[model samples]
Target: MSNTIYKNGIFGPNEWAVLEDEADLPESGKVLVSPDRFLALEGSAPEGVELGVVIRAGEKAERLVAHLAKLPMVAIDFPKFSDGRGYSSARLLREKFGYKGELRAIGDVLIDQIPFMIRCGIGSFEISHAPTRRALEEDRLNEVPIYLQPVGRDGEVPLGTRPWARRRVA
Candidate 1:
């Protein structure tokens, strides 16, 4: 079952669907992973193999950016129920690294964290298989209206953070 955390009144994941080694990965399509297991090989990632990383909080997120900048996608890990590291990490990945690809939540994905995850720049989520009633309650939290503002404002000033704030989405 997936676990979720609250961020800015919304719920999100602790980690994501990560494959351990190359054998655990498929030849094509998207493959999830954690930072610790990522093999630093330029062009080693097979064609059509969209590798992802499951960051265990925002601790080394900034440092990993230069390395992750080469990848296609990354997922943040939340560990425990109260862990907010993934939330902060997601924000940095988007604002600092300028990751323009997909950011998804894989582990402990409850309902309430969805909205905040989106604000933090997460575009996809892996909902749990056996969600309890608590999951439903949390999910409703994200259902509220979200103003056009990404999570942290460059970790300093919060202003015009939306990627499309300057354009019209019709």
Candidate 2:
């Protein structure tokens, strides 16, 4: 699954040149790759190739905390929409480990899931299906405003400040 649209299509000029398995590393440019490739390179990633990692669904994203400083983007897979583990992984990366990079949700991505993903601190979405692309493009996806609780590491005003919200910062 590929062809990502960041910020629910609200932002642009963020087009990514993602590196897939068995692909050649570009001579110069930011690139996103899989977790195995990042770990395989150790801390010696090729110069000029900005390194990013995509953690598969169900994988332990926390394992990469030590290397967070080296990453500008981290994608957590959602191989199946029913697999909700990526939500936790995303939260841990943002709230606990303090990952400030572009946190992406990839694979099996759907329009309805976008709002929830954002609440979990996912900043981008890798949308491969045409239906998802259409929904997002048309702004038909469900929108959840006035959250009762801020679930991730976002700058939500504290409980007393916002009557309808309570953010638990880890």
TM-score of each: 0.61, 0.75
Q: Write the per-residue lDDT of candidate 1 for residues 1-170, one digit (tens) a residue.
A: 23543334444654334577555556676666656556563457678677676676544776566676676677776565577778888887888778887777666765566666776788766555355335654454434343454333433224564554522222
**Each prediction's Cα lDDT score?**
0.61, 0.77
- Consecutive 10-residue window with the lowest summed lDDT within model 2: 161-170
Clashes of 2: 0
Regions of model 2 farther than 4 Å from truth:
1-3, 11-24, 145-170
Runs in model 1 with CA error above 4 Å? 1-17, 21-25, 67-69, 129-170
- TM-score, structure 1 vs. true: 0.61
lDDT measured at residue 149 in model 2 versus the true structure, 0 to 100: 59
- Assess candidate 2 and give its lDDT: 0.77
Number of clashes recorded per candidate: 16, 0
